[model samples]
Target: MTTGTPPPTAPKRSRARTFVPLAIAAWAVLEIWLLTLVADVAGGFTVLLLLLGGIVLGAVVTKAAGRRAFRNLTETLQQMPGRPGATAAPAAPAGGSKGNGFLMLAGLLLIIPGMISDVAGLLLLVPPVRAVLGRYTQRSLDRRMRSAAPGSFSDVFQQARMHRPDGKVVQGEVIRETDPQQGPSRNENPRPPLTP
Candidate 1:
């Protein structure tokens, strides 16, 4: 009889799958409400100009962030102590990718043409906010890589082994012969006598 605690049960509904749709719906409602309020105060023409400006700014920021990320990644790789093509462990924090991702997300939000989304995007562009977000993103990625399956891309860089208590064990013997042309001796297996 086993004395260990029972395994945790999976939830009937996936929170992420459900939460994403709900969050998007909420964002849309909030965006529309904010836009209506802004239009009432600032006039429709001003709101339209603001949206166009935001689009242009978002495009510029996205391009610059992408270029910066590529530059940082190249520099990091060049500084690693290993032969070319060798998969050396990441010498520097993966802040470049994370920052790029957040920046791209912010750009997308700004392009959505909603005052609420634009404000959120502008906040994301702040250096301190990006730094905090980058750290969070890095930790999340590390956690996912740790939990990934064997033979996956994550496994290629990981040096640790995964334990399996129920793994199979095979028993076998290997015999090697130096001479390729020699046959087995008669004592090992005698052949039938020749016909008279």
Candidate 2:
């Protein structure tokens, strides 16, 4: 008596949840391998020095970028109209805040002491790359907002009431009044009939 295709079989485990751990393991392995290779080519002391220098540079960059991003966000908020605790204004354009955030992230990555992360951090510092990433992020956020519930809870209830088969029936009489001097009026007033 069943209709349509059979339901797809469910997996015993979810791949999406496991992907992050697997990726982290792979990244750790790669970092260790690269570090070992570098140590073999350069001495241990040199590698230690490089790591210390990278940490220092990352700290400075992170501090500067964080300050800049905070300033940009503050400026944007100040530029927006309306008083505090009122309806929120639309978000400011993404260029400045997004770029500064990416820069801070890059600095954090550089501080992580991995060649791959350092390279990624450097790439994020590039203006064009940062701008493109910002645009993509903004678009993704817009899409998510668009996909969310479109109206308030009351609106949802009203729509449900309109469509339900067992909804309440409002019985009433509609009276059409006409002026003596003019033609008949089409205006309808719904109310109970007056009693003598």
Candidate 3:
């Protein structure tokens, strides 16, 4: 009689870690090839015009999105709790709700010298396309969040602090004395102050 044993389970790796870089590299190669083909068909001057036009359009789009996001932030802050006329409805994130991020991403893609990217960017600029893409992205993110282990998400932004010589977490702000005239110099504070 032989005893049965379970197979060792390997740690699961995120697809994004491997897939994103590979996809980006492949896209870069294909984009360069496509640009070369376009340049060959259309004169070099035409290609230059197209590239410049795309850059300018992208810049304008990006700037508009930035301004809109900033305005949204200001409005949200003004309406946040503890302020006047604070509503029961939760405030949507500045860029997240209105597809501002997608707009910015489209601008970035258009700014990049590539036909496929430019086409995609132009598509994203359209309201209907942006809405569809935003929904898809949100669903994917929600799915990922549901699958992720509890507390893992918070770990990504966890703060770190080195313990002092006394081996305790100090609750205080650190003030740097860059200008000698401002406060005590390094020599004066050789022994760090432990004022609670």
Candidate number with greatest lDDT: 3
What's the lDDT for all of these models?
Answer: 0.79, 0.77, 0.82
Off by over 4 Å in 1: 1-12, 76-98, 140-196
Task: Give the alpha carbon lDDT tens digit for every residue of 87-136 in model 1.
Answer: 56756555455568889888888888898889888999998998998888
**On residues 1-196, what C-alpha lDDT tens digit does candidate 2 reach at each position?**
8699988989778787889899999999998888888889997877788777777777887998988778876767676556564336565566555577788888898898877887888788788998999899999977766566758554575677778857755566566677769766556444579554
**Clashing residue pairs in candidate 1 (N, C-alpha, C atoms within 3 angstroms):** none
TM-score of each: 0.59, 0.59, 0.64
Model 3, 1-196: lDDT tens per residue?
8778978899898899889999999999998898889889997888889999999999999998898889888888888767888877866665454899999999998899888999989999998999999899999987886677656963343323232444454477666656666766647654475675
Question: Which candidate wins on TM-score?
Answer: 3
lDDT of 3 at 173: 61
Query: By summed lDDT, which 10 consecutive residues of candidate 1 come out lowest?
Result: 159-168
**lDDT-best of 1 and 2:** 1
Candidate 2 vs 3: which has more TM-score: 3
What is the lDDT, from 0 to 100, of the residue 185 in candidate 1? 56
